[model samples]
Target: MSFQEISPADTAESLRNGNAVLIDVREPHEYGAERIHGALLYPMSTFDPRALPIDSSRDVILHCGSAKRSGMALMRCAEAGVPINKHLAGGIMLWKREGLPTIKVDPATGRVFDPQQG
Candidate 1:
């Protein structure tokens, strides 16, 4: 089943307020290249329910490069009794498309950079 979506504005607000947990379901390599400032890494192939710091009662947002993987993860998380809270409506790409903040992690020296600059 498709999961509920939270708007970019709402997501940004929740994130700024430290009330939202952003779960990124992208590959480790891909994530190392670039991602949001603070997102939880949870590879779809190896999602451990117990590893999550989220409680089903709280706000937990999931995402992928686009929206496909996150959608799948959301269904699986719900099926596995992880949580039923809010998730990214259209993934990070959408969030970026909406001009949201995204951080690029340097693979060479492991440094983080702001995407807005370059």
Candidate 2:
């Protein structure tokens, strides 16, 4: 199964408009360090395609720190009979490079921190 790759900016916009669901396939620690705001945690290490929210009306976009992990997740999903075809082209690294916003999660308290506020 092939997947569609979207730009970070486009993905952000789609997410803001509720046109898509962003799934982050990175590890928990990586998610805590930095992640696209509003992305759902679905780490590849413990990924369960069946556990993913199924909403045919909404588009699902998977991503990781880079496209590598997300790509792997896509394959896994396909193998499991889960049809996920969209992903952030370059992942969070590209998202950051595109000047998009991300929230840093406080591991201890699970609080979200503003990336611009240091």
* Each candidate's clash count: 0, 0
Q: Cα deviation in Å at residue 100, candidate 2?
A: 0.2
Error of 1 at 45 (Å): 2.0
lDDT score, candidate 2? 0.88
**Clashes by residue pair, model 2:** none
Q: How close is candidate 1 to the true structure, as a TM-score?
A: 0.82
Question: What C-alpha lDDT values do all the predictions have?
Answer: 0.79, 0.88
TM-score of each: 0.82, 0.88
> With candidate 1 superimposed using the best TM-score fit, by how many Å does residue 2's alpha carbon deviate from the native?
6.7
